[model samples]
Target: MTANDTDTDVLIAGGGLAGATLALALARMVPQLRVTVAETFPLASNAEPSSYQPSYDARSTALAWGSKMIYDQLGLWPALAQHAAPIHHIHVSDRGHFGAARLHAAEYRQDALGYVVDNRWMGLCLVRELLKTQVQWLAPAEVTDMTCHGDNVRVTVTTAGETRELSARCLVVADGGRSDLRERLGFQVRHQPYGQNALIANVTTADSHQFSAYERFTDSGPMALLPHGSPTRASHQSALVWTLSDSELKEVLAMPDADKCTRLQKRFGWRLGRFTRIGECNHYPLALTLVDNPVRPGVALVGNAAHSLHPVAGQGFNLALRGLMTLVEQFRLAGEQGSNPGELAVLQRYQQLHRSDRVQTAGFSDSLIQIFGSPLAPLTAARNAGLMGLDLLPAAKRWFAGNAMGLGGRKARIQRPGFDNSKALNHD
Candidate 1:
């Protein structure tokens, strides 16, 4: 596919976090490339934003230090940081066990290991910043189908009540894990259920979290509490993710808010004091979702559409962000070489470069479940020893911290703000 023959250089099917981030990344790195994003959700324009209103039950995501750097390069960090709570420390422990490991931001020479912000707020900030870019946004729109021609893929888009076609040299499928397009296009997926479900909610404690995040693994299941609420102010709210088996989930799901909070307090302990309140409860089955092959001809997948892992490690979105940037880097190189982004060689190169990170990340999450889900005496003792060693070994702690912070892979080639070509790709 030659650039001049297609209606656009790249057409993204879903304008969720992955697609939106990709559009902005491309707009920054390869400004000359025509990029378009069509999403089912309506894309909001930059009309002076309304007053910030707090949603106690709002869902959130933990952005790794590396992900934050990527966003900083895109000049979106300032806005995001305003509402994001910095995770100054992370405390990992084996509940009712003897081992514990702690990671601090200062020890790692970072202001934060990560930042937590509401999912909706993040989307709003991304959308606002994206509106300032040269990329095109088509929404409340859906990319219903596509057909690949000699040099481009013609996309069928349904917007409002009308249907039309748009052609692009490259098509990126980022709809989601349950993507209709991904299914319709017949991309085979490998789905392995973990026999557990994750119960998520926002909880408040009597005392502030002090910007500390907690990861507690118990015989029952693993749970994580990320510092939430205002970034600039001390807050008592934290987002919770509790893993439970079917029967346990059924029991917990049937409880009232008070009983739910009581049960949560028992599982998490009194690290942040009593669980004063619990927000809306949401649950989803845990699974290892991997596409058999994420790339075909001019098309590729990113985010959950490509790989969705158990969230115990909180690496799912971070991994997707890294992959997104990596693909953008490939597109940048392809542009420099005057090769179409949709070219099979270009797509394969991107996939090859990204596959290791995907595999390693998915493995990390899967291993966590298997290793911790067991109740054998030997396994328990070994895990406790490992956790203790992690605390005692500085180098080992650094390695683990680095991976958790999404700094384990090769850096993407997106240029930072005010940086020139020769100075670009130096983000190591």
Candidate 2:
């Protein structure tokens, strides 16, 4: 069908975590709205290679407390919690330094600081929840072209062997860092490479993790070890994110399995005991990318398409989730007023509402990378002192904990208590 013939209220590009979650959110929040999600990857199957499933990759994600609340609103926590490992405490320290800080969930009166879940499990949960909704899913499809009009967006998508044009009142771009649609729309982005590569692997430790996450800073870069594995399992396993310079990354990637584990134990210290077994290792370049304008007349960008941050604080997805919730609220308001969801004013309002949070979160993540990654002795001392100070000051600790938990700044509609998700968009 031609763009003019096909009817859809919203067309979302990329059915990864962000796109799929947004689709499911709209389906629950605005049942009357027709939402369509186009994904380049096919529905995951046992035969599909791990590399083909971007959303269901082997990586693990740290979901903040606020993100957990969002999932609770979507009725997904019950399922996701089954596979998640709760992080009761976060231990931050500078390797080879005396400064260290510990953040506890009890200090903030919360059950968990965050939860770590395998990306594959999270994706499967999202897809499962999505299947239960009315949102249209077009997998193994790609958007080849897009044209924005005064009132709607025309999208040309290729699925199977046929190309079809579809029209939607709003086009939501959640295609991730290398978003083709974002480029097609000509959105300018400010990209900064950190000149570092992050090596990730699932590692087993001799001692039990005790549900704690660790962020250690070394001369090379920062390293994070997040608790992982099933609750009933006896062995201690954690997802490791080790940042290293290009040369160091190459050296580590080439090391023998036993030698690699020994080197990791030496660098990471004996906090979790000796690094025993490690799963397959993967590495990716690190960069900070932010779109100049995330919203236009008929479009809005969410998730990595809008802002991709360093994983230092694990805030990228949490920030994007908040932005998506804000956008959904704006659309609900517009629908209730019989206004176009893709109107420039509506999109701009959404952008303005989220601008501060986005800026702060991105800045926070970037600052952590720069300040902790610096090798200068003076700056290193300053950071060490900062960590020590955070541990000593209650108010400062509370503020930092709240921000780290994704509860700072203006709360999203989904975060506000008493806001009914089922009745959020009952305009009809």
Candidate 3:
């Protein structure tokens, strides 16, 4: 296969959430550009029984209000709204301390602070929307090698039993945190391990959650419980993210279900009533992985591939969505100007536009983990005071809430326009 074999303007590697969403966004925003997504996992129908994707597994994500806007623009909210649980309030407190802060949706005049959607459901919605677009899908396929040229990128992909070279003006890598493609390209990254693991599970409580979320800073780490499922569901449940040390996590995972629930209740207290039952639990090592530069000639990285942050604030996915919006905007402009999407200038503009948001969001989450995890008496006291001050100060509370809701900073909206084929031109 050569550049003339396939007419893909933008070829995306890794058809997980980010890649799939990007394909869909580009299709909607720049419909004239042909996009192809090559994924390592088989198509849903062709997937083997043992195939399990961590990013799209049993875990759940809290979608901030800003994320909701993106979904609304994509016309996907209606499909996902059914399975999502709205977060009407957020309660932040320090365990065994007097300092606490509460943020209510009513205060911001919004229906909910955020929403909790299971990844499985979210993936289904995205794939369904993707199938309706013109983007070509390649699954059970992996990119073996890639070479960048002045005007295009040549990607060698292995699918089924053959290797083929596909060409595109630009390539978007969303292969995730441990990205082989990124490593092959020699992109430098900064990684910091927190020596913590997040144990996630869905739990049913004796009382209703009323769509409120809780973030409790404990001696071990921060534990968060976000309401899950709709109010009409038969059982009241919430998603639990418990951070524990490596040793503590091993011991907890080895415990029997009954024992695990008991220990969890002891640590979490009676905030949401007794823990009746918990579903299967999964663990993820916590770390901060940041790419020094997320863009290269004819290439761009999104989601975990570019920056993977600790899940303390649940801003990882939300931040990625914002970045995607920015990338789409840049692509749309390039298309109109009939410029090469792979040009260094176009990629640099995206980097400059998104740098501040990435830095601020990553720093905010990292700071929370460090400050709350500190055992020093003075630092603990100061953190406690900070929490109380946030609660008492309306302006400060609003500022904090805005960032948490993903509404702070420059806003990017998806541009919906009729496809203009005349504006789309070949790179070389």
Name the top lDDT candidate: 1
Best model per TM-score:
1
Which scores greater on TM-score, model 1 or model 2? 1
Scored by lDDT, model 1 comes in at: 0.85
RMSD (CA, Å), candidate 3 to true, equals: 6.1
Which of candidates 1 and 3 is the stronger one according to TM-score?
1
List, residue by residue over 283-338, the lDDT tens digit for candidate 1.
99999999958998879989999999899788999989989888998999998998
Off by over 4 Å in 1: 44-51, 411-428
Clashes of each: 0, 0, 0
Q: Give the C-alpha miss distance for residue 254 in model 2, angstroms.
A: 1.1
What are the candidates' C-alpha RMSDs?
3.7, 4.5, 6.1
lDDT of 2 by residue, 157-270 (tens): 999989998888888989998888788889999999999988888888899899999999888888999888764443488889888889988998899889889989888999
Whole-model lDDT values for every prediction: 0.85, 0.83, 0.83
Can you write out model 3's per-residue Cα lDDT over 282-307, one digit (the tens) per residue? 88999999997989888998899999
Q: Estimate each model's TM-score.
A: 0.94, 0.91, 0.91
